[model samples]
Target: MRQVKHLLADKGSVVHSVSPAAPVIDAIRMMAEHHVGALIVMDGQRLAGIVSERDYARKVVLKGRSSSATPIAEIMTTEVVTVSPEDSVDHCMRLCTERRVRHLPVVDADRVGGVLSIGDLVKAVISEQTEQIEQLQRYIAG
Candidate 1:
């Protein structure tokens, strides 16, 4: 059972964030600069919400909201679901599946430690599967 901690080991604890008061355009720019799909919206020390490309498309573009004038907080999903470092990859996958969300912030003691995406879980699962297959092949040859 691979945990989020294990999967993020090589990636390190890097949580990309922005202020809730920031313009939606700023959030979009940051996401583009980082090449990430989402950004954690922070209100001081608290996790206020999350902004993503999808949010921009649905709320800003489709709804005719101005990205430059609109605050990220206005479009961000406030009911942010989270994961823990010790949480299993399977648990995160299930959460993503049920919530239809792609990203989850890893939290500890109400502090954001890192972020995990569906891609990260998929990569970890694929790596584990490949290792198991190699082990089985070796055993069969022996």
Candidate 2:
């Protein structure tokens, strides 16, 4: 199976993040601009939390909170689950499934490397499977 590093190399390590001090609306706007469902809430060099559209819906809309007034820190998921570059794609899949999180930030030596969505992992797994199937078929024919 491919490692997280390989995935990052293909996808590029562009981490779109927002400051925890920013308002929820700012985070939402940033997400829209980036065409991403979530944004890593960074406090300087620290990974403060993660804010997603789901977080906005559940914490702000459902709770009747004002997005413009609410800070990202208030709604963002602070107990983030992170992975290293060396971690396997399978490991990331398991973590996303068990933790019920859509995003996993890749950390290397306490620094943010990149963010992987569940879609990224699924796509990588499918590609790997497809390649394996083709190899098997070629071997069987020969």
- Name model 1 segments beyond 4 Å from true: none
Estimate, for each residue in 1-142, the C-alpha lDDT of model 1 and write its tens digit. 8998887786778889999889999999999999999999999999998999999999999998899999998999999999999999999999999999999999989999999989999888898899999999999999
Least lDDT summed over 10 consecutive residues: which range in candidate 2? 25-34
Each candidate's lDDT (Cα)? 0.93, 0.96
Clashes of 1: 0
Q: Candidate 2 residues 61-140, lDDT tens each? A: 99999999999999999999999999999999999999999999999999999999999999999999999999999999
TM-score of each: 0.98, 0.98
Candidate 1 — which pairs collide? none
- Identify the candidate with maximal lDDT: 2
Superposed by TM-score, candidate 1 places the C-alpha of residue 111 at a distance from the truth, in angstroms, of: 0.5
> Once superposed on the true structure, which residue ranges of model 2 sit more than 4 Å away at CA?
none
